[model samples]
Target: MATVRGEDIVNTARTALGVDYVWGGNSLTSGVDCSGLVQQVYARYGISLPRTTYNQINIGASVSPNKLRPGDLVFFDTDRKKSGPDHVGIYMGGGKFIHAPRPGASVKISSLAEGYYMDRWLGGRRVSGVSADPSSGGGYAEEVAPRLDAHELAETYGMSYAFFKSQPELWKLLNGAVSAQWTPERFQAAVKNTSWWKNNSDSVRQSQVLAKTDPATHKATMEAARVAARQLAVKMGAILSEKNVDQLAKNMVHLNWQEAQVQNYLGAYVKFSSDHVLGGMAGAAAKAIKAEAYRNGVAVTEQSVLNNAQYLVRGLTTMEQVQASIRQQSAGLYPAFAEQIKAGASIQELASPYIQVVAQELGVPDTDVDVYSPKVKAAMTRANAQGQPEAMNLGDFTQMVRNDPAWRKQPGVADKTLNVGRQVLADMGLGF
Candidate 1:
């Protein structure tokens, strides 16, 4: 069973204080009758009650007026002709109760001492699961001194005292839940559950905190931020002057904008100049730019490359230049593939010797080498281009062929292909 507290119930009910009254209405925001408010508040804390004053009066343990605490259902015989209790409200500490009095009255706090209520007080009943505060003698428990002072607690949670002090209701809710058993973890949970903490944008919350706690320092910081925003605006070709500088600076402080972010946004907005080679390029273009710089033996970081990309990409090799270099390297490394390279064979085609060996491992006959070798080469080209990743690497290609469906389907071919694969490797001065 879940634990329940009258403190929590009171806290929940307080949220609907201004709701309008409508007989039989169940909503907390729009409207709720007296019984509806009590039913809804209990339902939030996982307790269910009858929907009307008459039925709700008998469910919970009866508590006399002197022993009533927050969360006890307070009844009143408002209708003179009615036989039993005809209206209800949830008791809040301090001799007060909250309810939807009638069709015209909105949900509001009312004193039990008020003459009208004093004459009609029916009784108070404590909800079964709502834990009573023995120390309060039937009222809400007095708040105990926290282990850490407010300022210390605020600092521990990375907030200023002023920001913490601004949230009294939130603090009250948290204190009600964990004040008796305060631990750092429990207190931190309370802090994390707050809207202020959940939405604590550093630029807004932190900047606001600084502005309140130390105005002199905050002024200096805002000035610095303003200056940075102006310089960035100028760099990005945005207008900035005395007339709008203060507002722009305040906006920057609120937004947490800095140089790199502004540059990235403006870079995309204006688009890079055509002569600036890498200016507008990103993703694959950026990757190609980095590879080109590396191949050219130039040292450059992604950031540095992006910063001066338009100029940097100009120094990179073109596709034709790369092909010429490959042709030159191929002639020096493998003269036999020179004609094939000149014939426009792809890099995968140049690995024909390895592909033939893989085809042979799949039990492809010598007479079929010409017909099947192309298939093996095609497998190494690219998946989108018709090849598996396993076929891309020469070392993994033979194993891929060995695992091929064609090879596995043949009877008595495995042992013969294994021996053929070994002999093929030996002929190439290599071994498994």
Candidate 2:
């Protein structure tokens, strides 16, 4: 038997495009059913096929939907009640096929992209003896084959079209190596030889291999990635519409992101966004940390401090919770400020009112209160740093002020000291 060209078989099928449909009828001139149309078309090319859809599906090697070429036999389950393919058509290039319909319909061209056909699509088969050109490239079809559609193949391989298009070498190799009789082993070998594939990540390569070796797992993983992307977007306050979510999911699948990796990415994104926003929870935390760092004489940036506080941000749900976390961190870092923070007053708030009281007691001008307030706080910080008690109080402030030159300069200070000395001496029976 002579080898038949696929293009010739397609031409033969086209000749029966106007023929009427008849159940089990084998003559193309009279009437023919779907399988009859296929049988008669292949007979013209000298390639014998089975008489019915069920047997015809098992005629030769099976074809992936994405790998379908012209002259390949495509099958569908028109009747859901039936167990397997009950309808058949001859695939034409460019997502179309020619087939006869039920009783009154004639043979005509239809699209595989149509919803009805896609939903009912079972699979495709490449019959033996069909070739693009058996005489070319040492009887191999790979050399003379038409370029495979990259967009379709990308979708089949579970990659985004944009990403697939970006890699010129991958698509170029795919179009060059793939033929109607392509297999997963051949495809993997061809792709692995490329520089991009060899240098690519293991997870990504595994996902690509899985798409060919185990389509069911690959599809489920891709779907799970989509769901995870959406959930992470929501959690991070990232505005992701359905379209954005789909693209993100595709990218993740292409990169082979596990759930934990996705969470880390979203967490970093949320932290970066919140830290940059003024008046956000992260800003508040940074501000609090900055104040405590200053009081403790520790040098750090607002951004750095905020980053360090991320540990506290974890598992926290609200702004209030975040605020409380910041306070707790500050108290932990500077134990001396723990009392003031617990009392709901920042270091500045605790120092301001008490500094005014100390200045008034020493009869210092109101204008000097601001100048002395920092000095008093600094003294307290220094004292705490020197192994003193980790508490802030009025007594600490007063003692710090008394030792200062500003307090000693107040009027009537000498006479008051001499009077207090004479009273203490008279009481002890050693009066002047």
Error of 1 at 242 (Å): 72
| Alpha carbon lDDT of each predicted model | 0.65, 0.68
For residues 1-432, write the lDDT of model 1, one tens digit per residue.
565887788888899988889889899999999999999999997898889789999997888776777778899998898679989998887677888999888999976655467668898888787874656355555333234554444454455567555677556744554345454446667776777767767678678667767889999988897787666544543444564567667767776766554544434333233554332333334555555443322345656545433222233334455445545554433344456656765444456566476556665554455312555535433343433233355556666666668777667786776898999999999986
Backbone-clash count (model 2): 0
In candidate 1, residue 408 scores what lDDT? 72
Model 1 lDDT, full chain set = 0.65
TM-scores, all candidates, are 0.32, 0.36
Question: Residue 140 deviation, candidate 2, in Å?
Answer: 27
Off by over 4 Å in 1: 133-432
Which pairs clash (backbone N, Cα, C closer than 3 Å) in model 1? 276-310, 277-310
TM-score of 2: 0.36
Q: How well is each residue in 207-286 modelled by candidate 2, as lDDT tens digits?
A: 76567657788899889978988776665444455776776687788786665555455444344443454223344555
* Candidate 2 lDDT: 0.68
